[model samples]
Target: CLSSQHTEGNVGTKSEEKLIELIPLIISCSREKHIWKHIYVFLTPGLKWHSAGVVRPTLTVLPPSKEEDKQSSATVVCLATGGFPSNWKLGWTVGGTSTSSGVSTSLEVLGTDGRYSWSSTLSLSADQWRKAGSVSCEASLSGQSPVTQTLDPDHCSE
Candidate 1:
């Protein structure tokens, strides 16, 4: 028992019966008002619709925790947040050389605002971290230019 109404407005609402049925579920949540506000905002017109697909992400390099052992390795994490489409490539390079060892990437997490966040980590030995040249993390998607963040390995000195 479902029905959809087509209006000139940019947003639409579910049938009254469906909303009544959803009341119980909404009441159990703390964000009921917030959810309803979004519904209302969606149903009304006169608002500009911005496409999230072209939104560029903000990139960050999380500071790595220091390791006391010279033989031990440290993890460098790069995070890209607030992007759309949920498909992005993350690659690691050390001194202009592509290195795939000790790398881990997480699946993109979709946010409530329709954007996404992704993260990748690379492990580097203490010697490599202290003596290596440039380390870069690149994030890319089809049809869009890639975004890169570079870090100096020498800056990781203990």
Candidate 2:
């Protein structure tokens, strides 16, 4: 996880505003002789105001209860919060086989701080889930191991 954070430095009073003409930053305030102020500037090159953090994903199998031993469809929805400046890939895995047609992914929505919150859903037939196979939602990012969560059809229906 690559995160950029800046902390406020101790500034003493009796200081005057200093600006390099070559730089593009604009300071609107002047420091008094007896006052001190600390400022923290946060910015990311590819991502804005990013915090280095890993996302812990939550899984919801909708139509929560379903019929058993029958062919039906259910939704495997995953919601992840608090991931930074990275793209995520979500897929549907049935009995450890990845299904491309059964998966549909969504774009990342901008968060309050300009970070991203993402959601992806996979709809599969009931038989695939009921076969005692594993249905998983995996959130993939660069340089980090993907976070995967599994749902059990039998246990989910009960």
Candidate 3:
């Protein structure tokens, strides 16, 4: 069993005396049919608790990537040209928030073979784009974290 004890000043320590507890199971191997079944084992342990305070989780925001930091300002525009067959929703995030207004989404275009494509655009003046925290073209699939491409001021206007 795995166990730990914590003290006010120290992080929890694992119990070394009984570090392992084993559970056994009967198993059969196709390649070793003559052996019939072999014994399989696993270890599980009980955890101990202590009074030492736990560290609080700190919120961490990743800095915009180096490339993105440059794409700011100038006539800002966002585009999603393809990948519609996957039902990817395209949108923007500015100053760490999702934005729907000040944007225009296009109608889906269907290809001859049942595939589709779509585009969305978010525009801003050069000055506003420079000072804004971030400009992101986010593509999200249902029930999944969005994959975003951040446009940095350096990549923009220039």
Candidate 4:
């Protein structure tokens, strides 16, 4: 026989708490029964179960450098930081359309605060950039709404 129970209680302070699940298993052999207990704990702050340990990434879109402005091609960088789990994906969109050409993404780097940071660079021709409309960078995680930052080239300072 197997049974499970869930319990919640405060941990450390009033702003922090944890959810604990206890599962008890019973085994029978030769008319004898033994019981074993398993415990699982989830640390939650403020007793909020939504997103729990998951932290949404902050996104930033950087305009092209001065040197790039004089060149035939321009490069823009998208930075995503302060996210947990290290599984976030960074993507780029040009004029509301997904694009992969001349796009490079870096591996997720672990930070001192136990979060993750990553970046993606998009390179476009000078002519394409002027007509790119709106460039957007998106940081997405499974089952969560993506965080996006958009930049309009026409409004950027040279």
lDDT of 4 by residue, 1-158 (tens): 43334333432333333332222323233344464433222323344322224589999999887778788788999999998657889999998999999999999875545567999999998878889999999998887799999999999987
Question: For this target, which candidate reaches the highest lDDT against the unseen true structure?
Answer: 4
Consecutive 10-residue window with the lowest summed lDDT within model 3: 51-60
Question: What overall lDDT, based on C-alpha atoms, would model 3 receive against the true structure?
Answer: 0.48
TM-score of 4: 0.68
The superposed Cα distance between candidate 3 and the true structure at residue 98, in angstroms, equals: 1.6
Better of 1 and 4 by TM-score: 4
Ranked by lDDT from best down, the candidates are: 4, 1, 2, 3
What is candidate 2's lDDT per residue for 1-158, written digit by digit as tens?
11123223422222133311111122324445433322222342343332234354434434324442344766677776656543666666767877776666778765555355777777666666568467777777766677777776656645
Of the two candidates 1 and 3, the one with more favorable lDDT, higher being better, is 1
Error of 4 at 9 (Å): 12
Error of 3 at 75 (Å): 4.5
**RMSD of candidate 2 to the true fold?**
12.0
Candidate 3 regions exceeding 4 Å error are 1-75, 81-86
TM-score of 1: 0.65
Model 2 CA lDDT for position 70: 48
Model 3, TM vs. native = 0.45
lDDT of 3 by residue, 77-114 (tens): 44444342335666778768887877776676533322
**Candidate 1: pairs in clash:** none
TM-score of each: 0.65, 0.57, 0.45, 0.68
